[model samples]
Target chain A: MEKLKYALFTGCTAKQSTPEQMMSTMAVANKLGIELVELTEASCCGASHLQDYDDFLSLVLNARNIAYAEKHGLTMVTICNTCQLNTAMTKHRLDNNEELKAKVNEKLAEVGLEYKGTSPVTHFLYAIIDDFGLDKLKEMVVTPLSQFNIAPFYGCHNIRPSELQNETHKSAENPYNPTSLDDLIIACGGMNVDYDEKNKCCGFHAELQSPHTAAALTGNAIAGAMDNNADWMVTPCPLCHLKLDTQADHASEAIGREVELPVLHMQQMVGLALGCTPAELGLKHHVTKVDFV
Target chain B: MSTEHKITTQNVNFKVFRFNADEDYLPYYEDYNMEVTSEEVVLDILNRIKWDHDGSFSYRRSCRHGICGACAIKVNGRSTLACKESMNDMIDLFGNELTIEPLSKKRAIKDMIIDKADFWDKHAAVQPYLVAEIDEAPTSENLVSPEEENALDDADLCIQCGACHYACPAVEHNEDFFGPAAFAAAYRFSADVRDHSETRLADVNEEKQGVWDCVKCFECAEACPKEINPIGKITKLHQMAFQEGIAKNNVAVRHAVGFKKSIVKNGVLDEGGLVLYSEGPAIVKHIPVALKMFSKGKIVPPWGITKSENLDEIKKLVKSSSTAKF
Candidate 1:
């Protein structure tokens, strides 16, 4: 068997706000023998905010990010849902429309780059199921998380608006009831806690706009998982993790109770099963304490 | 002589929502078992349930075709037009059991029917009508360029179905949110070259309840049956707000501008700086979380961060591609 390599595009949240996501992803990739080539030169994917501010700039920026992966001749894998959406959307638009591609390429030419659309963009959760088989993952799990009930939060960007998601990834999870995260949890020998808000938005993007509304949304999702007896919540997107972890105070206010739920990045949960130490996965960096370990 | 075509039948269990404000304090589901064929639409099944199983089974329906948008309901957790959704497709997507409910649980007035008063209120708040110049009543056909019409994109096709309104998580969580349907309607009228509504952009430029409140979840877009991307229209409203200098000092705009500035300047987001930039002095509210995050090594000081290696390239791209002033 050959090594599965990818151009790792760790968006700003994992790099800045939630460094543990980056740390755990690296540890898990190392354990799985998958080579991750970090795209250091890649800028932000506009985070859906910049796209609203300036769509052209967002398109060109994502075009540049994809062009770098095309330059590397490897598939671009993102740990963040918004990055996956924006980059995949950029690729989809570019690949389908020659005129749009030409406009983007004209911008890229100034930076001495070109988007050939050779590289496909995908979230790490999908990458695990598609590239690294769940069966292979099951075999590598030394410490199964059967003791804990894990709630899988499939954030909106990676799933909804299926037109873009289905175009980029080979096996797009059903947006209505996403099971890739749950399947991964089951593969790691963890019990999947069923909840209504499992496939709902975390309100991360609206945090800056309406903090109270965002908190209420997060509180509802966390409360739903808690009501179903989930020991901890896990998410593939760092933005969701950022909100689910950091907004405990506001979330508590909205839920009318003290809210304390340890939120883990998708890789950190996988790392636990892969026999990585809490320190190695940066679990201690979490605002919400990881007592389940 | 008649041509013969194969019709496959399968047993499907329909779990329909049962609620009456007059009698039921809480809503419940009633199960109806029926054998359905591939030729049937969801409306056909609903009609059969009302006609045969229970004449009391209640729902809304208008033009049986997909146009009227009156038969929109939740089918197997997705808000869709019952008249347009094929039985075969639903089965293919969600298996044998289908859960049917009203567009919104909170607004449910009866089985498969919701009080659309709030939806209409929000739509009205956006002033969803052609408001031409006060003095200029159309004496002749008002000409609109093809490009201007094309820019509306399928926004004109929206039948006010309320599917996007019900599907939006923002609206579900925040009552004040104008929702995707309202915003799409706003864009349709506001962006029209014919309608000279000066206050259209200002109307939807609110902080906690307007275009800014949209979380970019894309749920509304997914729920739109006509392929009218409501999120896209909402973003266009945001762009128009910025372009027309509407609500320049709004926190959402400030946050967005801050985000763009951070990316263009450093090639990546400075999370710490962004908080202060977005909230201004209100950053004091987040001091505890900031301190906690700093202690945990989740965040670092501005000086501690590394600028992107290709910062020059990023700056050039931003300067070249963006004409909108942040």
Candidate 2:
């Protein structure tokens, strides 16, 4: 098998609010023999917030971020769903529109970085399924997660806005009924617990705007998974993990119960199945204790 | 019937949401098993269920085409126009077993029929009409420029189906959120070069209930049968708010603006600074959460963080792109 290398784009949350996601991701990559070149020079992918303020600036910033992967001749792999969407949206726009590409490249030229649109942006969840085949991953599972029933939270940016997602991946999971996360859960020997809010938002974007609504959104998603008898929930986006883990108390207030469902990052779940110790995967940093592990 | 068109049939199990406001205190699913033709649409199946099986089975439909938007329903957990969804496509996507329900974030009036009163009320809140300052009734003439007309393509395609509105998670969580359809309608008229509505942007600029409330989930874009891309319109409305100098003091606006400033300064977002700046004195409320995160080693002091190595280039890119139009 050929070596799997990528320009790892760890968005803000994984580095700041949810560092465990980064730790677990690195551990999983090491075990899987995948070379991850951290894009230390790349700026934030605007996180959809910058796009709201200045779409042009967001585009240029993402163009610069993707340009790093172009420099390294590797595909950019993001662990944050928003980063994946914003960067891929930039790549899609720059590759499709000549005028926008010229303008972005002009900005990039001053920065000594020209976006040739050579790098394709994708989420790490997709990378595991597409680049690292599930069959191979199943073979590498040292400690199967057969004892747990996990719910896969396919947060909004990972799948929705299907147009860009489809353009980014040849076999993009259907946004209506996404199964990649479930497939990953199965590959790790965990039972897939289906729920209504599996594909919904975690209210990370709405946190500042409407605190109560954000809490309710988080509460509803957790409640949905918990109600369906899921032992724990796992998500591909660090932003979702942050909200689902940290604000779980506030979320409990919104749902009128003490809901404490442990949430894991996608890579952390895989790390456990790959025989990595709980502390080695940075499970101790989570607000909700991973007592199961 | 044309003999050239091959007729294929399959037995489809349809589990439809059944509820009548006057009778049932709780809603339940009713199943109807029927053999449907491959060429038929969801509307055709619904018609057969209502006419042949149960006359009490109710749903809204008109035009029998994609237009008029009355036939919008949840087919296999996705909001779509029943009249537009081909049976073969539905079967291919989901199996022959389908669970049909009314549009989510809505009150069910009966099987597949939702109460659209709030939907229209929110739509009305945006003043979904042209507010031109015409002195007299205009003669036959094209008022908008070709370029202006082209910009209105996506917003104008809205059929007012409420699919996008119901599909929105913001509306699902918060009642005050002027739903996606209203936002699209707001964009449709407010963005028209011919309309001179001074209050349109202000109307949708409410702190928590307006454009800021959108979760940016993009479910609205996926749910629109007409491909209206309502989230795209809401995003433009955010840009318009900034361009027009509306709601500068809003927390959401401040939060969005903080991202730009942070990126320009550090080449990365200063999350702590962002919350402090956006929330202002409201940051006091987050102290508990902050301390919890601090104890868990999730956050670091601002001085301890390392700045991106390409800060100079990122700053230059920001300076250059600031002057460039989107």
- Which candidate number has the best DockQ? 2
Alpha-carbon runs more than 4 Å astray in model 2: B1-5, B137-142, B323-326
Q: Between which residue pairs do clashes occur in model 2? A: none
Clashing pairs in 1: none
Reference interface contacts recovered per candidate: 0.73, 0.80
TM-scores vs. true structure, each candidate? 0.97, 0.97
Tens-place lDDT per residue, model 1, B1-326, is 29888899999998989999889999999999999998999999989999998888889999998999899999877989999999999998889998999999878887988899999999999888898764466577767889999988778899998999999988887899999999999999888877878877887987656899998889999999998999999999998887787756867888777877888878888888887898898888888878888888888778877677788998999888885785
Residue-pair clashes per candidate, as listed? 0, 0
Candidate 1 CAPRI grade: medium
On the 0 to 100 scale, the lDDT of residue A25 in model 2 is 94
* lDDT for residue A13 in candidate 1, whole number 0-100: 79
Residue-wise lDDT of candidate 1 within A89-133, one digit each (tens)? Answer: 888888999999999889889989999989988888888898889
- Residue A211, candidate 1: Cα error in Å is 1.4
Instruction: State the displacement of the C-alpha of residue A131, model 1, in Å, after optimal TM-score superposition.
Output: 1.1
